[model samples]
Target chain A: MTQKTDQDYILEVRSGNVNAYAILVTKYKDMMFTLALRMVGNREDAEEIAQDTFVKAYTSLSTFKGTSKFSTWLYRIVYNTSLDYIKKKKRVILSEHIDEIHEASIGTMQDAMSYLEAQEKKETIERALLQLPEEERVLLTLFYFEELSLKEITEIVHISYENVKIKLHRSRKKLYHILKNVVEPIYLSHGSRK
Target chain B: MEAENKKLDQFTKEVIQDAGLSSPSVDFLANVMAEVSKEESLVKAQNPLITKVGWMIIASLFAVFTFVLTRFSLGFSILGDWDLSSLMIEKYEMNVDIPITYAYCFFFLLVFVIIQINFIKKYFYRSLKN
Candidate 1:
């Protein structure tokens, strides 16, 4: 039997089979949860936002005309919902200005990332992600980790294509700046202890 | 400079992709579905045969009708001399004078009703929004 597409599940949901919605929630919950976690830096808040995103999507499923892919539509909801939650809670994301980081930091990032082991690298990336501001942090997650294209990112994020590119570039730089700090200690520990 | 930046971008992407996806706690899916189920029930429960506003309008009309029926000597004229006597009785059989207090109360209710409808709607909206 063929695995049902997102659209099939969406159709089932529209016809009132609530269990079909469970299939959708199962499929994309991780994506929504990860994206929300990246944005808020708290697992509890992230989970709440993800749950709310699915619930909101289910309720508003009828309004979804088949104009775009369902994942893209779903991404848009999760993105806005995260932002709304952040705004409502007045959580300080510590908006760091990207331009202030020196250009030299960018050169070291690639080399430093290569030196770390897989698990260390992953932890470093998460640590670095939490340090960056909300908007750029999400942009990086979608573009690089999720492997979504710039155009797809634009659709989900509702930013102009050009702005997405520019922000992605700046976000990369800002992320590397944070990663640089975290990796230096690990690098020394590897040399001295390992 | 350009070559270096491209390499940097590649390494960044590789490093993040290597980090892999994060999973929520074990019960995440159950919790989400529970919320969805609750929402589904709420959607099904709303908009009964006559909604709150519908009932309000019907009640208002009924009150006005009963007042008219009881206060004034009732009559029905569907056509020229087509007397359906069930509705044709000279009902209540009283000549009532409109008291100033009644008019005052009626006007107050008229204004209060507009405010009341808005308040009720907002109240329901806030409750249902959660």
Candidate 2:
């Protein structure tokens, strides 16, 4: 889908046309939620953070200087708010530990495990994504799902650009190891025996 | 480095496209915008003029109060032996020396004056012009 220029939306929203913000929210909600889901590892918390991010963006709308893309600012709020929620919850959600998830039965994972085996490996990768550390998870989510560049990710997370690169590398490596272990014979044996 | 980078890029692309992650619903955007509108309504309910005037009055009062206090403190000074000679001499036979407390008071008063004057000059010139 062709997205409208952020400048056009910002101008309209700032001029008291709040409905303009709806368009922006629609366009970026997926990107924002995906980032939150990865960091917090729960759909409920991700949805809450996503909603809170928009509310915050609205309240602080006037302070939004036009120097950076509005999406960058929006994503920063999502990342920070999700982090705050994670801290408040005091425990990582169970989804973060699962390395093998049967994709087809995502909706049915709670009822049956055998059904999940028929699903694609992609679901498992998402579950594996949750296993990553906060910094790495955020970097990967932003770079991949959000389609943000290294420089933009640096700005959103308030870290040095080099730090983003380093984290991205380490995180990707960890994700690969986790995914590989799940596919190995040891993992299969454990699953079959269970 | 190049090969690893290519592999990572490929993996990133694959994950984003193929992952079964649910996209945000259209209603989510509508809900957020509705919230923005609600906040806008709340801000609109408050009288901007009254808020600005109230802040201005507070700031002015603080400056005036600070100035008066500073001036009062500055005027108090330590009494000297000669200055108190008549009063002390008449009341008692003790010869005493009293040092003026003006230095500390005056220093503080000067600071208050500087602060007030600076605020007035800055505000009047910038705000009163247009």
Candidate 3:
């Protein structure tokens, strides 16, 4: 038998089988939570945002015209919910701080240390990701982690396609800068051994 | 410099691969299910079908009433020279006094509809809350 699709569950839910919605909630919870975590940087807040996103999606399921992929529609809800929380909390990403971050060039960083274990590099990357500004963090999460298409991301973030490309490029550079900051010290420490 | 840039790019790819999606707690689905159940109950309580049927029944009753009134008026006109007021009085005395019963039933139905409206309003208000 073919695997049941998101649309199958959606139709069932719309037909008054409310329990069918649980399948969708379970399927998308991890991605939604990760997106929220990247945007909010707080596990509790991320969980709350994720829960609210699912609840809102359930209530407004009828409005989901299915023009986009289910994941895209869901990510849009998660993105908007996290953005609302950030706005409500007045968590401003200072442009001046971004300018300072831009000054940290990845070109100057030492070469990658071969001795660094995979787990160590992973931890360092996660740390760098967490330290990034919310916008860059979220963009990276959506583009790299979730592997969403640029068009899908543009729809979710409600930005022009051109702007999404620009922001995505800038976010990549910002992530490189952050990764450089994180791994540079380790490179220096391992330089003597190399 | 070129080799170093290649190494950094490779390392970034590794990092990106390692930074996988985050999973919520085990109870996350259960919590969401609970909320869904609550919303479903609220929606079921305010089922639009029930509302539509209620309105349909009321409308049908009104239509029947209009038909009866038209028949009564036509009967009075057909009786031409007879005293209309005395005929009404005689009909009331001989048959069941429908006016008094109709007034009482209408008043009770009005109260029932008002109560139902208030109940539906309260259900909506509760549903809109967190």
TM-score of chain A of each: 0.87, 0.77, 0.86
Docking class for model 3 is acceptable
Q: Which ten residues in a row have the lowest lDDT in candidate 2 chain B?
A: B121-130
Per-residue accuracy of model 1 over B1-130 as CA lDDT, tens digit each:
6765676687678767877788888898898788888777776666478888999999999999999878984476456686566574367566768999999999999999999988997687569867
Residue pairs clashing in model 1 are: none
lDDT of 2 by residue, B1-130 (tens): 5665566565555555556455665577777766676667666754456687799999999999999888767665665434754565647766765556777788889999999998986675445332
Cα lDDT, all candidates: 0.82, 0.72, 0.78
- Each prediction's RMSD over C-alphas, in Å, is 6.8, 12.4, 7.4
Regions of model 2 farther than 4 Å from truth: A1-4, A92-119, A184-194, B1-5, B49-130
Taking the tens digit of each residue's C-alpha lDDT, what string does model 3 give over B1-130? 4554455445455567677777888899999999889888777666666577799999999999999887766544665777668557575666655698899999999999999999988876676755
Top DockQ: which candidate number? Answer: 1
Residue B13 CA error for candidate 3 (Å)? 4.6
lDDT of 3: 0.78
Off by over 4 Å in 1: A95-111, A192-194, B50-122, B125-130
Highest lDDT scorer: 1
**TM-score, one value per model:** 0.75, 0.62, 0.75
Screening candidate 3 with a backbone cut-off below 3 angstroms (N, C-alpha, C), the clashing residue pairs are none
